[model samples]
Target: MSVPELETLLVADREQVRWITLNRPDRLNAISPAMLDELESVLTASADDPSVRVLVITGAGRAFCAGADLSPGPGDPDALPDVDLARSDAVFELLERQPQPVVAAVNGMACAGGLELLLCCDVVLAAAGVPIGDMHANAGLLPGAGGTYRLPRRVGLNPAMWLLLTGRTAPAEDFLRWGLVHRVVAAGELTAAAEELAKLLSGKSPLGLRRMKELVRDGLAQDRRTGLAHALAVAQAHQKSADYAEGVRAFAARRTPRFTGR
Candidate 1:
């Protein structure tokens, strides 16, 4: 099924995967205030829709995103953007908090806010040689989303510091080594690669995936002992779930499990 027509994005659903493509190729997919609104709506819908088991984000043309629209608008010609920065940042946050897994297909350049956008995804796959960086420094701006927070956690502080401070775009391969990108593929294969990975995730137990995501994300903020305790609690609860029972029965029967997500 199609989503409401969007000016700045395109949507395609297949095999329980909802693919969202940034449609502003002419603008290098630079996110405007309007795009943020449309994107937030899509993200919310994807989260609530049971058919959407995996979400993939990519961009049209040669770039993933150039970041936020900093152009002058009717409200204030001098202001960077008339949009509410907090509201705009919340859109990215919504993506981060999605129940199902989110995959980022970085086809090309991803800078400034673009970098922050991808940081929220659960899995990231980039085109080989694709340029990526925190262009905020280059533009005399700062990331309003979770860029500063999530980037360091994924790539470690030293690498995050260099990228955030220098604003120098590097090939996606560098990020793969730094543990930010999960894989780097040829430019021509980016979408197919992302969808393949999404397909693998789509068949998993929904409740199990959701629980594990919440557990790991929440545990990142706790000490080792505390995190282990939290995991134990979660395990106890999960064992009582329908999916867990089905999994064990399937193993005994030597057949695939049918997860009901209960």
Candidate 2:
């Protein structure tokens, strides 16, 4: 979809890159049930599209995402709508299951559910002033999203514990030091930096990149021997692919390889 068709969110396609923006600038791009549903659908749809080589999520306003919308209404409880977690499972599933890479351009405060979304992305780019926090416990609410699980894996137990327990906010620099974000750039430079990284990642063999993400995610749970065996199988499969041959040929010709992800 082009820029105008985008309503609550904007989906822009530029040379195999799909840029998704949370368009609720007035509310700091808060996560409403409808927003969550749309985000899941869009990401999942992009996952199946071979034309989309990379996916980037960002916010339209100054803040990336301020967490769930606590607007008052009949269905709204404690500000957030009472949508079943299952309804938005697609968001987490798409990120963890998709073959294409996902990046989050966290330009502003990304807290609670917003932070969880960032955690699911393969690469995270936060602006210098943006603060990342997990405030579920502080708010007297458990993380209905993926926060409870993914946080520890990304930032490790001790650091994750400190943040989770204290409900403290961490700046971009702190996250960079702890390896939460891939990079921290200036405010206006966030999107460009993220896109540059996406382009660099997209230039590689699509299948290789996909498999690498899958293995890295899955390997953490597997024993070393089993992980090695799985790695060998994946490596062998890629070695036999037509794109592998094309990669070799391109190297010989000193030209850019056109990977079909076969």
Candidate 3:
């Protein structure tokens, strides 16, 4: 299938996985307001398309994203008028609410707002040696995009505080210990590894994936009892899905299940 034409992004579909590349190599794939708009449009389309089962977001050239584009061209139509919490929150919410799983393939430098963007992904895989950090403190600023909350949830309170306070960039491998990164691969293998993971996830039942993602994300803010209750409710509801039946029959038949994502 032909991929959609986009100026700030290069998108492609393979084996039901949609790969969205941040394509601003000169700026190290910095997030301009135009890029944010393009991302929202692409993600909205992917969410509505039944063929798209998973999403892998990465950057072009040497960096994943160097943060927001503070300097935009005069002709840039999608440039944000200002950097504010509401705008940042909206973008992050768009990312988090997508039904399909979103994976961040952090290929290189991910700092400041870039790191905040990565936090929105369901899974994060980073290239070894790539630097990652919360750099807002360096600029005498704070994380405006779910970073303050998401960072602590991902890496724990103390680690999040250290990163945010120091404004120091650490190698990607360092974050694996903190659970900020799911996997760290050699720089050359980053794309392939991310693709492999995305394909693996895409083959599963779509309903199951979406529900599980929702449960985990929502459960984070709830008490243990409340979270368990939510999980049980989802499990009960999923029993009525066609994919659930196929999964059970396939297990009994010793065969691979064909999930229609129902």
**lDDT (C-alpha) at residue 63 in model 2:** 86
Instruction: Please tell me which model should have the higher lDDT, number 2 or number 3.
Output: 3
Pairs in steric clash, model 2:
70-79
Q: Candidate 3 lDDT, tens digit per residue, 119-187?
A: 899899998889999988997887888899889988999989999999999898878999989999998
* Residue 123, candidate 3: alpha-carbon lDDT: 90
For each candidate, the alpha-carbon lDDT, in order, equals 0.88, 0.83, 0.88
Candidate 3 residue 157 C-alpha distance from true site, Å? 1.2
Q: Please, what are the lDDT tens digits per residue for candidate 1 over residues 165-261?
A: 9989889999999998999998888878987899888878888999999998889889999999999999999999999999899999999787777
Ranking by TM-score: 1, 3, 2
Q: Number of backbone collisions per candidate, in order?
A: 0, 1, 0
Angstrom error of the Cα, residue 138, model 2: value is 2.3
After aligning candidate 2 to the native by TM-score, how far in Å is the CA of 261 from where it should be?
Answer: 1.7
Where model 1 places Cα greater than 4 Å from the true spot, the runs are: 1-4, 74-79
Candidate 2 per-residue lDDT over residues 38-59, each given as its tens digit: 7767876787788888888899
The true-versus-predicted C-alpha distance at residue 40 of model 1, in Å, is 1.2
Q: How much is 16 displaced in model 1, in angstroms?
A: 0.7
In model 3, what are the clashing residue pairs, if there are any? Answer: none
RMSD of each: 1.8, 2.4, 2.9
